[model samples]
Target: MGVGGAGCSAAFAIASSQGFQVTGCDIEKTSPYLDKRLKKFVSIGHDPAHLKNSEVIAYSPAVTSFDSDNEELVMARKRGLEVLPWDLFVAKELLKNKFVIAVAGTHGKSTVTAMVGVLLEKAGIDPTCLVGAIVVDWGCNYRVGESKYFVIEADEYSEKFLNFTPNIAAITNIEFDHPEYFRDFDHLKETFKKFADKLQEDSVLIVGSDVNLKNNNGKTNKVSGPADLNLKMVGGFNQKNAAIAAAVAQELGIEKDSIKKTLESFKGVARRFEFIGEEKGVLVFDDYAHHPTAISETLRAVREKFPDKKILVVFQPHLFTRTKVLFDDFVRSFTEAPVDKIILVDIFAAREKDEAAVSSLDLTRAIVGGKAKYIPSLEGAATYLVKEVSVGDVVITMGAGDIYRLPTRLLEKLEGKG
Candidate 1:
């Protein structure tokens, strides 16, 4: 259900491409993927009646977490119809008899997955791909190719990635995240170890140089991209992601020249330092970096790219649990970055109740120096930025939530159309 989400939307598209009659519904009325991919629209919300014609129900993780007792789910259980989470459905049904290359990590898995898919495609493998973010080259989050190869981004949240028995896998990097689910850092690491163990006996597990897995059954390859490789994307983290992709491509017998060519030309997935056109000489960009490490790396890259420009960050904390658990880290990330101004919006609180102990204002207060301000709303942040930002300033709208919408709103206001 929750097909409006990136993962579910890609699953819907992949299932449909495989000739399944797919119909979906989400709390959201529309999304880019829904508009482009979904052919059948069920209702906007969960309804038991929607399951009458369905033989199987594949739901997103959000639906399972937020609406556990949803009417559709209840109806499906009462009717004895098959029900599966999106990842399990893909792993069990779609990946059957295919050469699966699943990329799993705490970060950069989406980009790495897209890169591997593109590399395989360039080498005439014609592999099917399902990524968490929209690959700019494919114009969608998925690419359907008629081949035995299946490439996918294996998310570790809720331990959903364990369902896949991949022929090859990559771990870009690992750190403590999803504080809501994991008990502790060791627990998170152990879960990753289990995911690594899911690899077949002869399967190759390509890991970044920074990854430290205690034990893995598969043959592990520690790789890092060449320092001199020219890439269009910014950041050393991206170079690391490319290296892992190259390793995976190499395992699949793709040549070095083809892999390098594909990696250099990759336009990158949407919302990962994606450039939104400049308005009134203010260069704007959007990114989906919710975690502290991601924020630090992203801002560092932006600062390195535009050393002299006044970089303004409008950040919205994605989840209250994360903000509370990693509160100090969040403060340090912003304080350490080479940013000039910081605007903090309210926490997104996705699928979680508001933790009265924590808020964006708390984070703003924690940041050292007089650089951060709590704006409380996206609209307020946009309005403030419209007046505060000047020519040559680099503005970045960053978060995993609805913060991506602000760049367009800010640009419209800058253009005097909003």
Candidate 2:
């Protein structure tokens, strides 16, 4: 019922495109996918009345986790409706009888999923696709193609990806994340291994060179190095993502020319190193790099692109559990890159309460050098940046939270609008 989120919204859109009469509700009234894709009215908040006519209710993970006593969910249970999480609903209903190409990993799955979708479309495969982020070319998170092929960004959180048995799969890379759910790194790896083992006989499983899923059922292919082709997207990680997509396309018998053409022209998904705009010679970009590894890789890429430019990073740590669990890595990630300044805003705390021991100030204090500063609010960060930022500076808004809103404020202030 929470269709405003990226995952649930894409699922709802796919269901609607498949000619199902779907109704949705969310705490928020608006989203980009709601506007561009499912342009219909949805209930603003959860209510038992909202579930009146629905035979089956599909809910987002956030809906149940954040508010277990939500009225709609309670009512659905009382009525004995067949309620399912969005992932399970998509897997059991929509993806049935399809050639599923599921992409799973800690990072890069969204880009790889979008790339595979675009490559398949270029090769006239007409594959139905769903990714976690909005692909710039598609202008949405899903494509409703006519073929039996289904390409999806299979998420690992809560072991949700285990719902689907893919004919083809890809593991971009694996790292410990979602500390609140997983016990440790070994648990996370075991979950991935289980996912890999779900593949059908003679199916293909493409992995990065560093991934080691020992006993997967499918034929394994290891892809390494930056793709040799010219790419429009920056970063070594993206080149690796393209290489994985190429491997998948090759497995499906797509022509080399078509794969190359798609990867070269692919614009990229929203918020993964998305360029906002430039003002007064200060280039602004927004990225969804909240994890320590992603933060390091992204900043390294930016430094490589603009070697002489001073990078001002505005980082909002995503969840308190994550910040606490990976605090040391977070500290080291900043130092690994040549970033000039790091502004740390308060942790986003997506679905968790504040931990007394961990905060953004703690992270700032943990940084080795004096490059980091703790700003408690987005408004304060924007104000400080507008005053401190100058020519030849590359400003990056890095986070998975509402920190994306800061870039617009900074751009407006730069234009003297505020």
Off by over 4 Å in 1: 35-42, 214-217, 224-227
Candidate 1 structure quality by residue, lDDT tens digits, 1-418: 8888888888888888899988888887657665453645546888887886799899988997797788889889889999989888898889989999999998899999999999998899999999999899999899999999999999999999999888898998889999999998899989988988888778888888878763255588888553346899999889888889999999988898888898999999999999987999899999999999999999999999999999999999999899999999999999898999999999998889884979999999999998999999999999999999888999998999999999999999999933
RMSD of each: 1.5, 1.3
- Per-residue CA lDDT of model 2 for 275-389, tens digit only, reads 9998877899999998999999999999999998889999999999999999999989986668999999999977788758699999998897789999999999988988887
lDDT of each: 0.89, 0.89
Cα deviation at 87, candidate 2, in Å, is: 0.2
Total clashes for model 1: 0
